[model samples]
Target: MNKRLLSTSFLAIVACLLWATPFAAIKIGLKYTTPLNFAGIRFFISGLLILPFIPKFKAKLRGLSSKSWKLIIQVALLQTTFLYGLFYTGIDYLPGALGAMLIGAQPLFAAILAHLMMKNDKMTWTKISAILLGMLGVCIISLGRADFVLTTTIPLGVGILILNNIVGSMGNVIVARDTQEIPPRILASFSMILGGIMLILVSIPLEQPNWTIHPSEYYFALGWLAIVSAMAITIWFGLLGRKGVKVSNLNTWKFIIPIFGACISWLILPNESPDFISILGMLVIAFSLLMLNYFNKKRIKQ
Candidate 1:
């Protein structure tokens, strides 16, 4: 049990770290193309990248059940299409710091939804407290990086991001609950491809994107983003399908994303640097994870 816990935790951190590095890459890619268009291309390549790794991909694709296909389509729509669509729109209305902060709140929403939706994932006081602590850490980190100014659009952005979190949580719970028979890679591959196509179709009418050649930098960013999506998302889906994994507890690790993201920004972006508050926020997040794990182990022992 302990070994499984440690292994899952390690993979969770890895997945979150991969997720953390992509913000800058997305920003870089956006410089060369529209948001939905770039995202569509990135995810399409991500799905294709995974295809080569699965043994007998053609047979597996043909063998998937109608229920599996339905699950895949549902996940594709909620997780990738709606989630990213709202994500880009929300970010447009807020500062990057505020956007990151809101995005970081996903785990909180996940926890609450899991408690309501899954009998085994009921919310305990310790769990709630720990998640709240992580949220506080997210806020501290965001505030440290930039000023939070209130504008008229703030409410709209916050609402959209809240919806984004809820939709994403719904997708996570569905996978954890309903995808035991499906291989992780298959689920991720099909969902991302379908979702990518859906995004591109919508982008054509709305974004009016020009199909033009992009610079090497843009391709580099797109490649990295696709690779990250393919690897990290597969790891995540695997984790979700593992026995004894709770959607809420698994999602708590996402708190590290903003911390790692801040560190990455400081390293790569000239305008960014580590500050006292950010370090303090990192410490708080570290403590929160400790609290979460401590409580989890105690519960298991009983």
Candidate 2:
């Protein structure tokens, strides 16, 4: 691969890994704080932390049209504030395995949204099969952990998570569009900061959260997550904006998150063990990824 592709791959892989392990932190942080407010505090601090370092970021903001600002705000609303709000709240009420399964649905939604919105990313049967395999692998992995309970009953939590996936997917599609107007870093910073403010606004009336109740570990988790968010968000925006990149292709890498989540859970939490079934699920996920990326690329060469 070319250097640019190599760099993007490295960044994308690491970013997904970072994104993968954070659900534990969010779950832990929620024990001491309300979901919405905790998310707001974490993302708001993330935006603050990211904004100052890039001096060139401000120069890129000049002369942006009103429409561009609107687009950025829409991204912020859907991607950060609304998406995370539903996510944190929904996960709070569901079993962890089920929640992971639902969250794993995001790439499917993203791929569908990309197919609908971006002509260049039209779906093929191969991509569809890959999506299914990846999702099934996730289900198997979660099931191995005793967290996967298939049910048709749509509870409030499931409803919220469904909406969360849709909104998050749409936001990703929006980001993937080639507007060529806003710089990626500036866009990332604005959406995060603004969306975070919106989350805080909602939290005040609905959650009225107590920020002071948590011990030092809570803050440590929150801080680590904030830093990860800063890195991941910026890298994602950069990747999405890169020429010739597809939203679906990048989102598929998110399947790796479950592998990390399962492993990390076994390490961090008591009673969680690495079982043979989960290991099998991990292998299936790897094969699915190879079919999606490697074989797909090789097919083009033929």
Candidate 3:
């Protein structure tokens, strides 16, 4: 039992690590294309990337029930379309490190939603305290930005990311609740395809359509984003369906994302650098994760 627990937790960490790369990758890709256009192409390709991995894929699609299909649509709409719509838009306006830090706020929203939606996932004081500390890290990092200003774009980007977290958390809970009938890969694939198509269609009227061919850097970023989305989202969905895995606990692994993402952004993005405040915020976030884990282990033992 402990072995299974450790394996699932490890896989969850792996998924978070993959997720960490997208902030910098997306920032790189956005330089060549518009937000919705870039996001649509990335996700559409990611959905396609998953098809080769599934065994007997044709038969599996043919066998899906209406409920499964509905769940897929719901998740695709919320998680992929709306979530990434806001994500791309927000990340476009903010620095990569700030964007990653804002996204690291997901566990707080996920914990609250899971508490309300799942009886088995009720909140504990330790969990609440830990989430609050993580949020503190987010605030610290944001406030520490050299370009920190009360500009329209700054607040708008922050608001969009907050909404993204809510929508993402809701999608996570829905998948956790109704994933019994569908395989995780199939759910992730169809939803991402449908959502990506929707975004592409919407982008035609909302944003300027791109026609020119791009350089190798654009393709590299896009390819990396798609590959990570396919692997990470599939892994995350699988973990969401695993028995005895709490949504809040699984999402807590995401704390590592901001740390890696901020560091990567500082290293790769010419405009980004690590400040003492940002590093301190990351340390606080790491300490909160440790506290959460210690409390969780104690709960399990009890």
In the order shown, the candidates' Cα RMSDs to the true structure are 1.9, 2.4, 2.7
Q: For residues 68-178, what per-residue lDDT tens digits would candidate 1 score against the true structure?
A: 999999999998899888888888889878988899999989999998888888888999999999999999988887767889999999899999999999999999988
Model 3 stretches with alpha carbons more than 4 Å out: 1-6, 91-101, 153-156, 266-275
- Candidate 3 TM-score, C-alpha based: 0.90
lDDT of candidate 2 over 220-260, digit per residue (tens): 89999899999899889888988878888889888888888
Local accuracy of candidate 3 as per-residue lDDT tens digits, 1-302: 57865587688878877987876677778788788888898889999999999889999999898888888999999989999888777876776557766887899999999999998999988999998898788667666764544556777888889999999999999989887679888998988999999899888899977859988988999999999999999999998998888999888888777677678778887998888998998898889888998898898899
Tell me which of candidates 2 and 3 scores higher on lDDT.
3
- Name the candidate, 1 or 3, with the larger lDDT value: 1
Compute each candidate's TM-score over C-alphas.
0.96, 0.92, 0.90
TM-score of candidate 1 relative to the true fold: 0.96
Worst 10 residues of 3 by lDDT: 143-152
Q: Tell me which residue pairs clash in candidate 1.
A: none
Number of residue pairs clashing in candidate 3, backbone atoms closer than 3 angstroms, sequence gap of 3 or more or interchain: 0
